[model samples]
Target: MKRKRIPNKKWAAPVLGLALVLPAALPAQAATPAQAAVKSIEFVGMNAPAGAQQMAQVYTGASVKVTYGDGTVKTFPLAYKQLFKSTDSVGGTIAGVSVDANGKPIMDTSAPNNPVPYVSDAPDANSLFQVPGMSPTSLGGNPLSLVTHYEYITSNNAGDSAYGLVPASMSLTKIDQNKTTGELTPVELQKVDFSGVDGLWIPCNGSLTPWNTHLGSEEYEADARAYEADPTQTYLSSFVQNYYQDTTKKGNPYDYNYIVEVSVDQDNKASAVKHYSLGRFSHELAKVAPDGKTVYFGDDGGNTMLFMYVADKAQDLSAGTLYAAKWIQTSAANGGSANLEWISLGHATDDEIRAEIDKGLTFSDIFETSDKPADGFATIKTYPSGKTEYLKLKPGMEKAAAFLESRRYAAMLGATSEFNKMEGVTLNAKDKKAYIAMSYVEKSMEKDSKGADPVDDIHVDKISSGVTYELSLGGGQKDRSGEAIASDYVPQTMKGLLWGEDLSAPDAKGDTAADDKVANPDNLSYSEQLRTLFIGEDSGMHANNYVWAYNIDTGKLSRILSTPSGAEATGLQAVEDLNGFSYVMSNLQHPGDEMIVPDPLKTEVLNNIDANFNNRKSGVVGYVSGIPSMEQIAAAAPEESGGGQISSPADDSLIPLRDTAQAAGAKVDWHGKNKEVVVTKGTHTLRLNVGEKTALLDGKSVSLPVVTQFSKGKVMFPSGVWDQFAKL
Candidate 1:
């Protein structure tokens, strides 16, 4: 209980409303009734960018009060991040301009579902992978074992016609060399200090602590809300230290507001610190928790609150306790389900949970306050359910008891559809599992006639897509599995994470899937040694900025990189040290809108579009291979080769794999660079640094770190990498 050390980047505004959170109040049940009655609304304002001269107007209505999930309750108006100009055409498709139950947009739908088929701009597409043993440098080089390199650096909170931003790239190659022409060009190693100012630091989704910080995340807002929503936009604010304290613009030397935490050296760059107590309202990633105590971050904006900071005094992790997973719905919970523990968030004191109206609290207490209890939380009861889900609420718990469990501690503040949108998170420290990437995106948009925004339209009925879940850390307070240290975290029973999907998608649907169909989805990176996962897709087919990979056990469709610039792979880290797992991205919206600036008010006016829009966009470590081991795919093809064996898309109900072993001889570690790989595992173990010299493994003998002792013969270790010979 050493609480009260709250001085490290204090932020006390966003609805300190009143604070009173109650869930043990019980007995009001009409099963559960108290949601649906609170309207007044009106705040619609964001538009004015196209070369701009002066536009600042954004207030976009504000009345608050939203709670749904049967408990019902509603009010209207309020969505930030606007540019709207389009008019009608509902999800039908056309020029494009819909999204207003909150994704912002009232008109402008003339043309947007056209281009969707590019597979590499093909200047050799990177050489297609030079055959023979393959080539990310003969399989043993920059393949995926990358030491460090991530790019994206421009996002202060939306709006960009290029007041700043640029410098995007992709790299990593290897995979039986299908001739991607010898890959490797990518080399930025990390750029995100953009708060240092240059490209505006739009870092996008980040957080990789273990003493080795890298927090990144800076989605946008500031420069006084991007110059009050539109005055032509300028950006630069984690507060800009109170807007740069004094010095009138230009090289103000430093101060840069907050939410940064930089560090990546060994050549990877990154450097800042900020953290501003972890509050800015647009963050997108922060995972911490390796017993490093807790960090759990998320703001995804719109109504905001899926926090958790608890480090109190333990990990020296600055301060502690700040919970907000809210959602209880218990009638003895099951399937109809609802149970995400911890509540003691903050807004400072609890004037009634910072603000008002709590008849049994369910809307995040009206805007978060979950005070007290956080330091080492321990039970309020119930949390493990279904197979382990994602999106919200924890059940299997783990990561140090979902960071010390928090039961009935107090302070719950939620408002806005059971709590406005939250997305992406994964902490499967190998089975402890925890994955979430939600987006009811304003309860699945499609709300027009003022049911009050939701029908901003992105092809309605698929509700702008983007959802992922998985939990199962296994319960805390020692119901079992707590001190196991680490093992079992499957990437689902979810707790040590938070998609906490951070900002934009009040049904924005990946911004109308870039014109009549996004289905959002960005929230990726899984590679348990390539059981796979990747994802990305913020636009349509070729899936803009392409990146598929699914199959973690059977999600199926295992490899496809593509990318050259439909750019939107925002924040995706997968490192795997020894430079093996490579993938750092953060290309904020790179080729998105292709270079930006093509609204022409609406319609596909076509000014000459082509910043490499999706059909050719790959940078930020696109491919990386060489991880085959099952005695080298049983000598390169030998029935089942080894280990588990077949399909089911992870778990659609099992089936597949009993192929009796089938065989084309299996393994093939070849890393030429892009011809993708596919070996779900067979006791897999191909570890080649191929940095040079002494690299044999099939022939026997190995050793190469420090960049790789230095390549030359003896450099063996690729007995066909893992294998999957034809006809299995």
Candidate 2:
């Protein structure tokens, strides 16, 4: 593979200045009749103008219809306003404002707002009486008590150009529903801050911990060597020292990739704390089990491995014992099942590791310099506090080796490190199983190898799709000591339950046939009550990535929601409010409308672009309700003489297209060749294509889940389509 080289222009400036200055200082004696004139060559570099691409219009205040497995559909209108403009206020605090030592306004209290009365010894001591353009009166009620707070993690897809030099952050918000009108309002709290941790880099999907804190993962950190070598990156040196605590080294590779815990108090004041003991790597998500002691993490990169951290105590992840997983290959295919065993990579407290680094002992020095035995074990000695301790590294390494060089240490410890982008781990506590999503199972991970870059060494006959594996918790399996482990779930015997078929390459027609495909499963969430798993996509191969629900019992996958063009469906979480309404909180990230357009659109065409695209907003978080089953909806309805209209059977309720056309005073025609039904009412016409969810209404594409249905030899359609078509 050839790499592009950046021209070295540093010497150009000095050489050009020297040439210009020397000509004027030339001595008269040196100027001879036969002296040749100095020939000057000028090199001009031209910079092209920043090109603009066609930005897809962001859909705001729009309703999306969700079709269930039982043929029941529900529509959820945009609950929150499209978050594109930087100044568009979502939510903030009014009462907690106070002046800091620097005279800057800050939220003083971290107390969560609840029904319980709040008491302060000096309530008005350090409080600010007023703030310009902000109300003095506080909205003191606990707005988030009933509603779940969705902290959306936004990534700067456009790199430094999108959000300046700082890494993108997460936003905390809650959806409020109006009881009478059933309208939803999105209340924005404060944007999460990392404080002294500097800024996060490419924040990805995270997990809501058992203690209710958000475990945010940072992806794609800068290469340690590159950051240290570049003089312009000197500003990051202090940040690296603060996190890595290695003053002897210019930049530590151990910094900036661990899972950071973010907590939002009742007043919506957010704070962050990094848990360095969890072992740093390119983390995708960190899911805590029901016990809250064991946390499973997925590394989202090539040559990565599954990692687990068993905390010293429940709900406390600050200190833990880290381990890596080794898969016992039982099959020879991409989706093949494998029995898993955990290899202890050893552990140490954060303070102990920092102390070791202070003693000028790099994590690499302890393991890399140790002598290995023929039996595949190394004995490394360590002195934490003047007392020498020996570590019997089975597949041997240092105690702090896993925390510093996690991926490399795992591979050396006989753990499977060939997984390509292992992403999104979730637990099905009810079934005592853990589910992991592998985005596109590569051929390299299908076999065991000792070579570095196993991906290149293996042969891939066919391009494999993404797959979700279900691993059983230890129910009857015995550990190395032959002791029966009870519910001590380590990932073992993984079976492929769901496959993202759309990840396959495009066919001869340049079409992927992705209608039934759910490619690139990125974020996953499991519902205990519903026995369903929610899968979100992060792929550009599809026209619009979608959020799907896969029932564990029935094996039915439903495309519940689709995001706007050029955006990924992220942050899929299910929560129940006090009103008993189950809602799926989801985010649409980096909509396509923000991309640069190659050919500029005409003024008229550009004007049609939604105003939301006029500003730079990368993502939007919203909630989807009305997701109950048809039977549940019907059961909840009140009894009446003719029964409730919404609960009636679809066959009797749906009206024929001919009858609707006559009532609307429109002409109807059926095109057998195209398998389309055309209905024209005055100047407006709708083309309903059979077996397709999309319909063309007056030259505009509209999604109608069931555009036309056949009932009793008559072509019938949902009556709801009439109401929507009439408005158009």
Candidate 3:
């Protein structure tokens, strides 16, 4: 094999008093100088320009100050790009729309254009799953895909809160990425069919599973107890019945509020299943920890309790043990701090719970209620919303009650149900910390609300604008019953990380909170490589919601994105790297939704939305661009490395299977029967058949510039075949 040397571009050194070590491998050059590595990136914060906040569009004026090992500082401004909107029809159908029995599009006659996009007013939660072995350039290819869930639709332009009135939906969109410019485009969208699970209900915030599936939610679960007493008492059940559009069929309140997992194949087909074992409540989202089995949930409604579900097996949420946190408040300052202790609720499998639901068990079957504290009834408790209830568990309904009436059961078990509007839960694996977004820190979490509550664990000052809390993770913890907890990733303590301040009066832009700080932090995604935590706002306090990037290392807060006036900054997911590029996925919902926009700016905001979006009826799913890849960030850290050759260029260039695949953090396997070599990483898979001029990438056949060969106990593939996995 004759080696060819490509010209190497030298990076100037000693630019900013920083030195980075370069890893070896330089195209077989005779004497290639070490390229300067990236040392760090400092994000320079920028204020939202005056007129931009008054418009109905996503905006970002933030820039990243990158420092090279050689001390050179380069600035890359954060850019926002919308791949698609809820109102935009993709694949001949608008996302988040209801269908009649005949499959006709259900129209919102009151709104312009007539096509109904459910929760177009509240598009939330985005999960980007990269299919293994699939590439953007592959045959009929869809390597990268996005699954976005809509929370709920508004009845009118004033944004009146009406939830569980219709079956919400999540969309699976195939994404196309430009190899050269790193631009992401939505190629096609297919609404995930939830008919198997009786249709999705208020699908809210979601997270991507470690196994590359979208874990969505059915929030604002119907009150089954109330529904049993009166058929019209439950909102979600009747709507779900309407979703079925069948006269004889009745919606079961128990079926509409559980964790929904949607798995997408390489061909872009999606299938969803409801995990009943995770317990049902007003679920914001369930985030699985790095351990895979340990899951944490964000219960969105008032009087919500923090929850954790440890699955019986890794990558499976069908069966788990549910536990509620008892917040042992340590300090009341800055939105409070607490040492958490887990109180075991019970354990059950999805099948068991499903069987129970199939049996038509009502709330009366699981619990007994009383207006006062009787001998059998539990003590009276006040909800964070100021409602009072007295309940007692039935003798044989522990599992049934825990899995079905999770909120009431947790409260009955002495768990702290003080969290208000807990929105999103995300993790920083490197730091072993979990960050939870409290959209508004008030209600039962405040000191004044303890008058009627038996358990007053949280007693922090009211900060209605909200705060983000960091939970420290540790091992060797036991449940309150003294039983050793199985998972080591349990959260030990929690403290406020970042917060928003409520202003005494409205700001110049008509915002009740300071424009510079975060208001109503709702969605969160953390990037360990970037050392930054991304916070998305769902704020009525601020005229325009913004997505801010908080650097954990530098302690600098940078406003990276500003959504349209009266819109919510939701669907936040930070992808450290995908096909060698990084992205911070963000979406804006319900522009011009501000019913409280000050009189001076209300008209201007609405006018801008009419000119841009579909008169505040549309929401966008997109990402923050111009971020460096994980490979580049990893190269920034100082390290010593021995040089190694990667390619052997003969008359026909050949690439070493192990060296090349391992370099990409991929695993290589050989099949003797098929005489094939397979490389897999995450959701991607690459397969090479010996002597064939074609290779299979995530099941799609791709042409090889040269055939693969097995020679002398070693299998080597052509550079062209190898390049398919690396190149766009």
Candidate 4:
């Protein structure tokens, strides 16, 4: 059944209430029940950036719906909070940046972790590249204190050929949480030193492992085959020269382009390790299955292959068997559907691969290649950027070829290498499903000409905006070799869930795609508790990229966020429960990027950004706020239903003490000596004497309308005192 699509419009009203569903009619009553559950939350979508004043604005408001156990429904308006910006200094250094003494970014091999600040020519990051991946974690801290550890990745230093060479850095921040309203305040930001693994390269989207570690990726890996042939090559091979600070030293391409796992200690110190067991490629991100042993990879870039790794033991990624996907297309409509079969590409241990890289094993030592057809060489066209080559594996080089030249070898063995711009992978553990974001539905994904060199398996119509495919997970499946797969989390089939709508012509805002739907969906994160998938866009087609919330059960798509014009929406991490509160992390990169913006509106967008974001030099790392806890939302219904008295926090005369005080993260204590009540949050304190219409605030006596009292063991206080706690 086709679901009705929600059109995009400029929300005229401050709050738009949307009730997803309601329960059956309840008996008429004098009051509604106190306990209510959150039925669904639908955020209002903002219009495309228009005039100069609105181009750099970020929407931070939403409407939430709550349903009580007795079937009574209500709606609430909430606002999002901004924690910090990229230009904000952390431990005296800007987030995701490194500079010299003169404050100029060092892009050469003079020092490590410092690259060209600004990148042009694409609708991507500006001076401060996006913090694409963030993992919010708690490291054995006080449960009541609400302390969270956040580690985010900076994708690259610059765009075009200068990308993937300079090593990227991951930053760790300690945040203080307010339990009452679920607000986050940053305490400190520290760079997680990656020199232990010779620094990180192009770390992109990442995920948190089941054991609580940040699993990151290194995208656009330097071509080891090309570099081995011409050691003096300046473009891609310069990654080693820049890192070692010595161009004369022999560079080893195998040392980079692997999954990097970072662990943070209780003191907030961080350590990293590169998992070479995972095959080298243009890795966007990897998602570990609920079972921990099965892992899925989203290899970014053109002509990429879908890869999976199954570890020998749970929680250990050191040794695993790698497999590539073969798409058996069942339908070519709506981004296509495929029943997948895995082809084993061999496996090895991380220690062994590291040893080979240390020994300086070149590409020629692993395989023999020829320009024309030969007796031993096989026709394989799986090189990065779509290069075809004739190659034959040498004896005893199976493990080397599998780990280093994974894509080329996979194609030689009959695996699908036609996926374009596969960006991020996320799992819906509750439903046993996984999602992969295809940033572009073009190139090899489309049907080819009759005389094309090699036939392609995936042949779907082009949708420039992109598609997010959902894969069903199941067990008892075998690989193409008929060998029993060890893990039960293998994906069986894949189909499109959220697809973008490409416009026949440019819209008024010069957007080539519909402003309402997702365009170039890149980042994905799923919340099992909410049954919603959060998507972030990396689109050049849309004037202002957006972040969306898609509810799986109801097929409802809500545009929850919109970044500044020319900026990419990224850093999407959804936390279902953090000290009883829920949060969704959505960040922006490169405001006022004018790569694809029409010439007419370029000056307006730039001027607006200059007024708001320091001349388009800032990017934000923050999360949506005001999300009520599931525990608070699941209020039980009274057995005998009645019309409940509703009280707005803004104008209520009387308020319940327990709910109000706890919601404010304030502690309430009974004082028996004076027969009074005491409330405290931070440094502020309030004391109320029973039967007296007066209160003491910070030792100053203040008049109150009503005296503090108790009703059936529940404390009740005047709503006027609410402001005293709020100010704290």
TM-score of each: 0.26, 0.60, 0.82, 0.76
Candidate 3: list runs displaced more than 4 Å.
Answer: 1-36, 52-54, 100-104, 109-119, 133-142, 156-162, 247-249, 380-386, 632-728
lDDT of each: 0.30, 0.48, 0.72, 0.65
What CA root-mean-square deviation does each model show from the true structure? 26.7, 23.3, 10.5, 11.7
Per model, state how many residue pairs clash. 195, 11, 10, 11
lDDT ranking of the models: 3, 4, 2, 1
lDDT of 1: 0.30
lDDT string, candidate 2, 1-728, tens digits: 00001011010000000000111011113333111111111111111111122223322222333322223444444333232222234554311111122222322122344221111000000000101122111332213411111222122222222211222345454434453333345455444455445445445667777666778776544433234346244234533332233445354445467787776654546677777788867777688987788788877655567788878888888777787776766664546666777777666676665554455544435443323333444322111111111223333336556776666566655676656557778998758888888765654454434443322222222224467778887546544334433336666677666664542455321224253455666778876545667777655344445666666654655555655444556666765322223456665654553221223332322343334432323345454555432222223322321111221123324578878776675656564434667775422456676667566654456655454676786777667666555432
Candidate 4 on 1-728: residue-level lDDT in tens?
00010011110000011222222112123132321222233444434445656656776445556554445555555555666777677556556553222333335432356634532111111111111122333532212111111222223433233344444456666665664655666667665566667666666677788776778777776777777777554244455555555567565778778888777665556677999989999778778997889999888777789998999999999999999999999987767899999999887999988988887888899889888888978776653636668889999988888998889888888899888778878998768999998877877788876646465799987777788999999889889999978888998899977677777787667777777677888888886655677788877677777777777776666677777887777667886545446677777766775445666776777777778766666767777765544433432223242212222234336677768887776656554434666665332346676777776654456676666677777767788567544542
User: Who is ahead in lDDT, 1 or 3?
Assistant: 3
TM-score of candidate 2 versus the correct structure, residues matched by position: 0.60
lDDT, residue 464, model 2: 43
* Evaluation by TM-score, superior candidate among 1 and 4: 4
Q: What order do you get sorting by TM-score, best first? A: 3, 4, 2, 1
Candidate with the greatest lDDT versus the true structure = 3
> Between 3 and 4, whose lDDT is larger?
3
